[model samples]
Target: GGLVHYVTWPGSSRLLVSDPAALKHILLTNQRNFPRPRQQMSLLRKVVGANSLLATEGDTHRAARQRLNPHFRFANVSLVFPIFVETAHRLVDRWSKLIDADAAGGGAAIIDVHPELSHFTLDVIGLSGFGYDFDALASAGNPVTDAVNSLLTPLSLFVLLRSAIPALNALPLASLRKEKEARATVRGTVAKIVRKRMEQASEPVEK
Candidate 1:
């Protein structure tokens, strides 16, 4: 088997695995030995947590998966069908209203659905999965949405350079400072939601 190399810089070369069997062997059969590159993980850990399931590997990843398996089983998912249907009906209602308003204006109405779809996705996750109302669909300019979107703003030259040379992230650059603030806001918002849910859980249920 021959190797495939991608030249990134004058002295840097990144290897690419072209063979499917080799890819699977490295990624699945022997995953622990083929952990994500440090640079990629570092960027991701800033958005998610250091111990977040997506960022974890090896024993930590296996343990996290084991702990989370039950709630994702088919039997458990079937129980949440009603929540999914309710969220879907709300989405239809919102779009219907938009269409109706546009019809009243007497022009072929053009609607951009991408942002609304993102809101719907977030709202579904909040209501169906977490029993919380993010209100991302009902509210315009949600802070959480803004914070998460800002986190993924197309990589600027500054970001690309900093990613290539991680030491640059340590410097006080304006974009880097903004990225930190955005991540903090997302983390803080999620913590508040989790604390509220825990408090609700502790309350005694009424008959």
Candidate 2:
């Protein structure tokens, strides 16, 4: 079979598309003909919100892209490169502190860099995307950090099953309730930050 082929299971099948040209055609050139699957959209919409660019389709997605295009242009994106550099330096400093503390205790430094890297990523996103400082590396326990952690934490087996079988989502699960609360927190925090930015933009500049 070619790069594009179908994989079949007992009750369902999926088209596996790997060719770059075909991917472009499906995702950009002729996207309208290849709508995302309802289940895929439902899963994504839970995390990104229904109106987000990743969740929307057709005209809504196009309009959102148009609105965001200017800010994403290479020239504009380059302006945030310094933010990445600064955040990376902070990560290094944090690691150094950990190593020094370990040495002081006569113990080898055995740091798990995974959570540190995740915190670095969140800090970068907060600074570059929202002009807000999460300071995730310096501390923890903030509302935004807590909410994001809740959302990104590993899913329980029941939740995973629910995601794979949408019918299972209807069952009352405490994990699902926590997920709903986390989503609300994330959306509310983002809306508050965006509103603050808009207010600042509208204020008159002092000479």
Top lDDT model:
2
* Model 2 accuracy (lDDT, Cα): 0.85
> By TM-score, who's the top model here?
2
TM-score of each: 0.74, 0.76
User: How many steric overlaps are in each model, in order?
Assistant: 0, 0
lDDT of 2 by residue, 1-207 (tens): 336456654556677877788899999999999999786687778888889999999999999999999999999899899999999999999999999999999999998887778789989989999899988899858777777777666656665566679888676778778788889988998899999999999999999
Off by over 4 Å in 1: 1-27, 89-117
Model 2: pairs clashing at backbone N, Cα or C within 3 Å: none
Q: How many residue-pair clashes does candidate 2 contain?
A: 0
Please give, for residues 50-84, the per-residue lDDT of candidate 1 as tens digits: 99988888999889989999998999888778877
lDDT of each: 0.81, 0.85
